[model samples]
Target: MDLQESFINSPDHHRIPLLSWAPQTPTAVLVIAHGMAEHAARYQPLAQWLNQHQVAVIAVQHRGHGPHCPDADLGHYADKRGWQKVVDDLQQVVVHARKQYPDLPLTLFGHSMGSFIAQAFTQKYGDQIDNLILCATNRVDKPKLRASLVLVRSIKALRGKRHRSRLIDNMTFGTFNKAFVPNRTSHDWLSRDPQQVDRYLKDPLCGFSCTAGLWSDFIGGMLDINPRVWRKDLPVHLLAGSCDPVGEMGRGFSRHVTNLRAAGVKVASERLFEGARHELVNETNADEVWHHILNCLRPETHSVTE
Candidate 1:
């Protein structure tokens, strides 16, 4: 596998870091959008696996993630227009990927919060992508999300856009840890693998709280994307861990698929991994998850090799 790192200028003038893995002759290109509180480097395992299958992988560290994006602080995309900027950053990466692999089909693979961006991206740029892969995704209840947004907005108004609110963080993520009572870490819901959970807890950039404005923007964006009419012709593959609290233990994921179907999306596939958690890619059975992802992207491909 060949690895390369480069920076692309986003619409907001922020330099976004892109990590790429390529094979000598690529069959397709996958543009990966990582989740919140995490960076693209974590996807190296998946990228390498794709490379083995003659698939090229490009991952972007969204603004406020990793060490890139000097303009934005950790856990904060922007003071205003944060979610839009994240979406714009993804589009910029897609444009770059197309220029690099003009002939090969391109698939957009998004995880968690990134899935929300992918959903919104398809609404505007569905023609540009050949397939969409959403992992650990869910549909937001408008009423509940709006109420949370109000609280986040009020916090932003009082504490400023950059202020990190523990109250908000607890309200948002605290219940997730409850599912794994007597757990070793607060991020136990992230994965069943203890090592994976430990790595996240040790990483300073992994579990930090986001600014109130960031949360407000994220909820707003979720509401905007969740209700939009998706393109019926687009092929969408949704993956989730049945143990993932974010997906409401698969119920929310099913609801999301149902909603998309209701909106006339004709080509959609949903896969629920039993006992897997939020971070399927980092779960104990991650190789199985990867195999499912590969099959989704390239149905003709051979079985995953050990």
Candidate 2:
């Protein structure tokens, strides 16, 4: 089925926009949140792909990102202060969705920055979700790094309150360099797929630099919330690339999965792809990633009844 556009008024009084796609026989619902600067519409292909497989999808625009954004510099997410606000917004969206489709199993999928929010949301609303997936996220360690982030972000947040730039560039993805980065850098350092990178560049809504405030808020949120808090109670799946920058050295993004396991969280599984980049969902081997996700949607010995 084709996508249908809709909007919900935020409890805080913002206009929240969302897009939905329904298949003929729906098996489950997947709600997606796009990364920083980008809006939910970027997931059009993924949503359509899910719909073709009988999975309904609802991609919600983060507060500052899409039509809801009041300022060009601030998309669905602002900074740490607004991070929880974004999480609350996501919770509200999920609750609203549950009310609308009480019969459908609900799962949440977040990529990059969205993954950070997804992890926190899962912690806040673990009982509400049937399954949770996070892609291209890292655990926050090193208090020194956190301190540096906080210090830098404080300056940005102060500036954002008064004079903030309308456009912000993000170095998280950095420039696609082969030697300094991975092979996927040839296509797009962030994603392993050249076609996907090409499409992202061509799409006006796909790429934008995040603000200093956004970065600070993200770092604060990361430090404040430990995935371990929600790791045990939630059925979570994390997918990351071994060679990806996030997992480079002492960070040990994969080791964090084991930490989650220790906390007693039912980690459905954690997959580490060899040459994948940050955006595994947009990578050349994304088909393989898609298959793994489908498996999460349909666990072994469990069949879709409808």
Q: Local distance difference test, per candidate?
A: 0.87, 0.71
Candidate 2 ranges beyond 4 A from true positions: 67-71, 76-80, 142-145, 161-171, 175-187, 249-251, 301-306
Error of 2 at 258 (Å): 1.8
What would the per-residue lDDT of candidate 1 be over residues 190-249, giving only the tens digit for each residue? 999999999989877788888887888889998887434666777899999999999999
Cα TM-score per model: 0.96, 0.86
Q: Provide the lowest-lDDT 10-residue window in model 2.
A: 162-171
Alpha-carbon error at 138 in model 1, in Å?
0.7
